[model samples]
Target: MSIIGKCIGATVMAIAGASMAAGDPTGATASPQALALLGGLATAVSGNLAHEAYNKLGDKFGPLIFARYPEIDRNHHIIIALRLSHLDAVEAILRRFNESRSSDHDRERQEEAERVSELIKTYLREAKRFQGDTKGGRALEEREVLAALPKAFETALADRSGATPDVQAARHETEAQVLAELNRQIGSDLPPLFIRVFSGSESGQDGWYDLFVRAAASRLKDDEAFKSIWSAEQLSRIVHMLSLTAGKIDRVLDGQVIAAQDAERRHDEQIALQRRILETLSTEKGVPASELSPILERLLGHVDVPIADVPTVLANAVDGLLAKSKTLVAIHNDYPEIDRAINEARNKLKTLDIEGALTTIRSAQERQKELQKEQLRAEARLHFEEADILRPLYDHQGVIDALRRGIELDPEKYWQWCALGDEYVAIGERREALNTFNTALQVAQKFSGEREISVCYDRIGDMRQAGGDTAGALEAHQAGLEIARTLAERDPSNVDWQRDLSISHNKIGDIRKAGGDTAGALEAYQASLDIRKTLAER
Candidate 1:
């Protein structure tokens, strides 16, 4: 296995082994002469000793041996050099391959050789960086190998090696194959790397983004075209979408950690409470503390004891003590309710009526929860009313505070989030307003609230427009317009829906006009005018 294959885990190594084992009859493993017949690299395997030479090369290179050598021979010395980390040998072979290429050599074959040679060179260069020397005197550490190989693979994917269309096509095909091999070499690291790269602080796109973009470009088989499409806005959208997924996963993991900590804390508290009660009972009864310690352990010290068994365990222990002493029975009189409840639970379990036994407690818990929810709902209503009162008074801060409180209590109410966002806009808090509106949009989307969703998009568009992001603004407005158009078509007689459609068209027109897209602006404006005219005539 390669150094990168080691870091990435045994799974990738197994896959690579499987692929080679499945048989590649056209590959160097078959004959080396067939490679010459396929692409005109007859010089690569010169003497009758070529077959013997290939057999001596070992499994280190696998299919790459076929891909790598064009004019270079199938001598096993290259394998020995690579094993000894002899980068100079690799470099010499590449230089020789390029030098040997001419008008006589097959152009397609030469380009494929060039592409594969570059991939090997690039990967070696990257892997050598951690070695602190240009000459490869030592092997790469697993961590360094893991870091370098993926980067090299991504770089090769993005690189345009030649000027001609044919060369570019050949390079693209070679890159796909090389990248697939790289994937086999480091597939285990990709998912964790993706999560790590995509999660955390929102900042400008970095090398990790490029790495993903490479994968996407390779799949599309158009590196240059794919790169051209990645405008600032497009990149931002991509980052946001990927980061959102990573963030969700991070949150779920965080929640699990917190829940585990909370459970452990509760268990510790329960053990402490049991110990305190036992200590008090022992002190009051003038019983030796050592005698009560075993009872406490039976009740709580055993960490594996199921919580459900606690009631029965305690009841049995108490019955045992009470049967042995009148003093304990007199003492148990003070805690008759606890004893009775435990006895009741134990009896229910014995009779297999567990649900019925817990009904009284569950009902009380449910009632308390209902009362709490009612209180919170009433409080949220007051805050929303306060926001409404403050809105007309031009107290944007007050409105924001009230709406925020209301949203905290009733997060599902998308309108409250929208209202809060409006207050942020009024206060000229563009980033805050944009984020709040996005939150509103997410809530609306969850419920499939089309009108609310449209409103959120329009608000987000407005913020983007004010921030001088014409492209982003246009996209957001177009999205809102799509939803508004659907609503208007579904009910043309609805005046509000028709008005919303007109406003959405106007928003798109405004963005296009600001962006110097005159024809697009005019078309959008005409649509808005037509909608208004129909509404006015009605």
Candidate 2:
């Protein structure tokens, strides 16, 4: 095994052994010292490991600790420090503990010393990523160092109760020195950004903001201005609430940035579409190039009109343009390019060839039918665009109406069928939704990609699952999974297909777990995790 692998194995065994040795059978009574040492060991092991490795270690060990110690889970300062990779704070914790026990010379003490030394060596070996050691003054330095300091200090003083007066005095002096430094770094007053709590799930985070607030309050509590109005506990609560509010504000700002980006993207697409429309009008509809600019400017103003009026607006505009183009044709010509067919039929009539004339008429009817179909398809496209606009507004009825209109005009559009089915689901019409989805499945199987067919199956599975039909849901998901597997195997380099395969596995796992098929669920979940792990590695 590699050096890091060996370190991981040793660390896990050591922690597990300690927990097992605890008198409490549940490992619930493991001493704070043991848990702190465990955290210190984690900090050391994760110092040299990749972020993925760090998370994996946490996932493996966090539950064992949290299940027995819910309070630690609630106030997970050490976990936050690990996440930040704040070497200074974590190292301080270990150094303080080791310093307090330095005079002990027992065999167990020596062994503990050896382990701590090895762990510190492991941590310092890759010290370049640590704060102040990074080469290029990397822009992102961890602030959780400051946030983790209070917990570090608290852990350091955990053994103060049994210490001699001199030792206790020394610890108190160290605390004052650290608090003074903290007060200097963090200002006396909290910022206005943290005045309100986050909109959803206040205090629901894994105690990250709570830890931050505690660190800030630990320093601020000594401030003369803050001390005048608020007690220590009240100050802590206020700071915690403010931090949550700051998080909410940050999320709102992020959403605004995303919305701006999306709007710009849509604007670009609209410009391209408008350019194509203008080009078609100039070349195909015989509109003069000089007149196109003014006509386009007028048409652009109509975009402000409501979504329901879009199809009618589009049809009227196009029909008026077509009428204008038709008037430009010669008076004698009822249809462009039909003159030859008319001439042929007249010649046959003159020759008394009634059968040939009838054949020409039938051909003309077929041509008219093709033109009518083309017109219907054009109208359908307008309705589809209307549906797209309505979707974001959550006007489900409008979307259903528009999609249904489009489907009526062009039944071959399989995606429209699927979309219509989704709208049916939104309206709580399960029977109609199922029938529509089945129709979509049939259409998708006939003409769409296998991916779409799989999507249909997944949707059907969701519906069945919601209706207490676990077996049916599993069957449908398994069908989708088979298709996804095939697609992924066919093109191993395609990230999308690989992701689809993983999603299929996860869905299957969920269904099996719901149905009490624990073994099958585990197998499916493992397969999904394997794919996701490979993807993450890449």
> How many clashes in each candidate?
0, 1
Best by TM-score: 1
- List ranges where model 1 is wrong by over 4 Å: 1-371
lDDT (tens digit, per residue) of candidate 2 on 301-381: 775865445434544665564443333323255575565565666555443344565577567766877899999999999
- List lDDT for all candidates, in order: 0.52, 0.55
Q: Candidate 1 versus the native: TM-score?
A: 0.41
Kindly list the per-residue Cα lDDT of model 1 for residues 1-538, writing each as its tens digit.
Answer: 4432222222122112112223222223332222111111111111112223223432333334333333333332222222223233334334544444433233456566556556656765764454222223222233222122222222221233422123224424433433344444433222222222222112223322233222222232222322232245533432342333333334434565798799999989977876666666656655555555555565565777776576556556655554433322222776564455555544543333434446633544556667788889888999999989989999998888888888788788888888888888888898999999899899999965799899989999999999998889988999999999999999989999999999999999898888899999899899999989998888
**C-alpha TM-score for every candidate:** 0.41, 0.37
The worst-scoring run of ten residues by lDDT in candidate 1 lies at 39-48
Query: How close to the true structure is residue 74 of candidate 2, measured as C-alpha lDDT?
Result: 29
